[model samples]
Target: MSDDKPVHTPLEIKLKLSLERQPLPNISYYQRLVGKLIYLTITKPDIAYSVSIASQFMHSPTMEHFNLVKKILRYLKGSVGHGIIMKKNESTQIIGYCDVDWAGNYIDHKSTTGYCTFVGGNLVTWKSKKQAVVARSSAEAEY
Candidate 1:
């Protein structure tokens, strides 16, 4: 991946991860890679969602899943030196923003929600996860 062109994003926005893909023979390596990524998420929120998606296939990964992991690595390579920054400031206001894609999961029709929190105009925490329950409408998903 050193020579491969780096992407600005960790994962494709329209990507639909499914379990119908061909399964791989060996999965020990995939699990190890995902485990490291999970640890990385503590400091790199940008790759948190993509890493979460990739880690889902730890039990029985496929070529598509492996490719997604590669994409994440490439993204990391391109985004070196990019991470949360804390600067001296007096602003103390807390702000948050969140959004969801209604019925994003092709398998179960569950929505995926992403959120971020900022303190004094600086990001402090963020998360992206699939909803446990299916949402009937976009408005419901937002709520």
Candidate 2:
């Protein structure tokens, strides 16, 4: 990428476990793998849901969780070309969409908030986060 000329071939990448991923025998490797995948969410929106679910068990990931993360990575490897592309637009409109999952968190009984912002037809930003306070109703969840 440093070179001015565009590279015709896809960039080769090597995914490796980080230092934080090691040193815990009881912990599952899925936590670290999911963390990496979540970081990639900025470029790839397809794996957002899977990564989010896998990340919920970061505090106590299991062997099952690790296998799921590995599967996600394998899926990504086979679909590396999948990603969002920003194109030249004719209009300048900023749009936002918001959604809430009522009492979605099984652990804390909290709702999850999701939103996506777009610049014209391009997806500029998005996030899925657990709400801090418990809501009494779906309307309250959005508020």
Candidate 1 displacement at residue 132 in angstroms: 0.7
lDDT of each: 0.88, 0.69
What CA RMSD would candidate 1 show?
1.4
Kindly report which residue stretches of model 1 are placed more than 4 angstroms away from their true locations once superposed: none
**Which residue pairs clash within candidate 1?**
none
**Model 2 per-residue lDDT tens digits across residues 6-114:** 3322222322222233333556455566678889987987677667766776886655556556667766766757689898979789999988878776566788788
How much RMSD separates candidate 2 from the native structure? 9.7
- Candidate 1: lDDT over CA atoms? 0.88
How high a TM-score does candidate 1 get? Answer: 0.92
Query: lDDT by residue for model 1 over 12-112, one digit each (tens)?
Result: 97798778889977689888988998999988898998898888678989988999999999999999999888887999999999988889877689898
lDDT of 2 at 140: 94
**Alpha-carbon runs more than 4 Å astray in model 2:** 1-28
